[model samples]
Target: MDDTPREEAGDEGAPPGGILDGTQEKSAQGGPPPPARSAPRRKPGKSRDHSAKRLANAGLAITAPTSRALGSTTIGGQLSAQLGTVAVSDTRGSVTQISYTATVSATNFTTTVGGNTSTISKPNISYWSGPATAVSGVGVFTPGQLAAANAIALTGSHTAFAVTSAVGNTSVSWNPTIIVRVPSSAAAGSYSGTITHSVA
Candidate 1:
């Protein structure tokens, strides 16, 4: 018997005679194997819906001095008698002139007057004075009618009088008064006039 063993042939279910094929097959012969299949892609989830809403809220609330009268309540009276007064004097027996101060006070008054009611919710009072005049030696001094230098200065010390009530309750009151002085040159005479007061 020969000593050499039989060589394996290709396709005989046996090893090839050479060690192994070194060159790679070209795609033209059988083409590279199909590329690996990838898993199906998933779609992105929908974004969260964002919508604005309008809201509203509502709430509601409801909210709301001094001169003397010359006559009686039924009529009127000198409102400043007790609160104010005037005085005069002569020095050397020479003719002198003097002027009296006029003052008005309101007791129960309001910012707005509707018939008998006032719009003022609280009580308030004010006072005012007129300008002063000088007396000359042996000369006459007559106090001019108390005129409001301006609308604001008319009331003298107390310009506006406000109160919650009139006489009984005593909610509020203003007592405005004035005093007069006579110089050696002042004249004597009775001075009178109407002091106007408006509720409104």
Candidate 2:
């Protein structure tokens, strides 16, 4: 019998260490495979800023009698026309002051009947400020204070009157009185005239 070692039957084509298929190769230094390199992260973008603004304004209005008729009067007697309440409103900004003006159309009342002219001179018209109100600001009635005793006179020329020293919206109301003193020798036949009131 031959004494030579016998070769393994089906192992002739196998690799030296017999490594398995699908196994990953180890690092040469034997440490865990270097962590898989990751893609670099991006720095955050720069931030930006973002705001708003407005202006102030104002307005005015008036409510009062547009016309009146004082009936017959005796010779040398006085005729009084009581025009109803006169109310003024000032709509303004928070820091704005309130004021207004008053005016009359003419100083004298004139009429002509059958080509004969008649005149009523020096017609007295006045206002007494009463019952005032204010909102959203202080109420300062300085140069515009009105009272019965300190009534303001209306004439042909425009006259400015302060309504309030306050810094916001304000309102003032009052009754107006017109007095006409008839002359002893005056000839009357239903006299008519106009009185105009204005505010600013």
Candidate 3:
């Protein structure tokens, strides 16, 4: 008889390849995979500016000629010398207020025949607008009987004034009438005085 021993099938342990789920078993020595890692995240903030600008302008025109003549009154004569208008525009984008003023360059009138011994003054300073669609009573200064130019205050203290965007020429316009007086007991001579305009 042969002296060889026979072996059984369930001899040792689990299958050599690994469990059926299919992840190859790590060698006993190798460590578990590093914990799952994910990228970092962030949140963001805000910014800005607010402001504005200004613009304005104005001008004067004599609707009537610059040269005017006056007639003498037996007692105190009154004559209209010149007629004119002023236009103001405000693009400043705000409601602005505007006013007018005037001054004589010379303190008094100068004439050939003993210039009337007096400071620059007028008898009447009347203001009116158009014959078409006039705006009445926007008057400045006084009229009739010895109006003084000895520093007249028809002019406002403010050099620059405000003009609202709503005001149109239809609303207001300047038409000044300068009247002079020569009392019966006055000097006999041809006198001349310059009426100047100043704005505020």
Evaluated with TM-score, which candidate comes out highest?
2
By lDDT rank, best first, the candidates go 2, 3, 1
Q: What is the Å distance of residue 4 in model 3 from its true position? A: 99
lDDT of 1 at 185: 26
C-alpha lDDT of residue 61 in model 3 = 19
Q: What TM-score, over all chains together, does every model reach?
A: 0.20, 0.54, 0.36
Candidate of highest lDDT: 2
Q: Judged by lDDT against the true structure, how good is candidate 1?
A: 0.24
The C-alpha lDDT values of all candidates are 0.24, 0.45, 0.29
Candidate 2 per-residue lDDT, tens place, 1-200, comes to: 11223222124653321211010111122234577888566567743322111112235555555445544454466655555565555565447554444333334555554689656664443433333433234554432324456655445443323455655666655555555655655554445555555554
- Model 1 agreement with the true structure over 144-192: per-residue lDDT tens digits: 3234332232223333332211111111122223222212221211122
Between prediction 1 and prediction 2, which has the larger TM-score? 2
Which regions of candidate 2 are displaced past 4 Å?
1-58, 101-106, 123-138, 141-155, 158-161
Task: Determine which window of 10 residues in candidate 3 has minimal summed lDDT.
Answer: 18-27
Q: Tell me the tens digit of each residue's lDDT in model 3 across 11-65.
A: 2442221111000111111234577888444344332222221113233211222
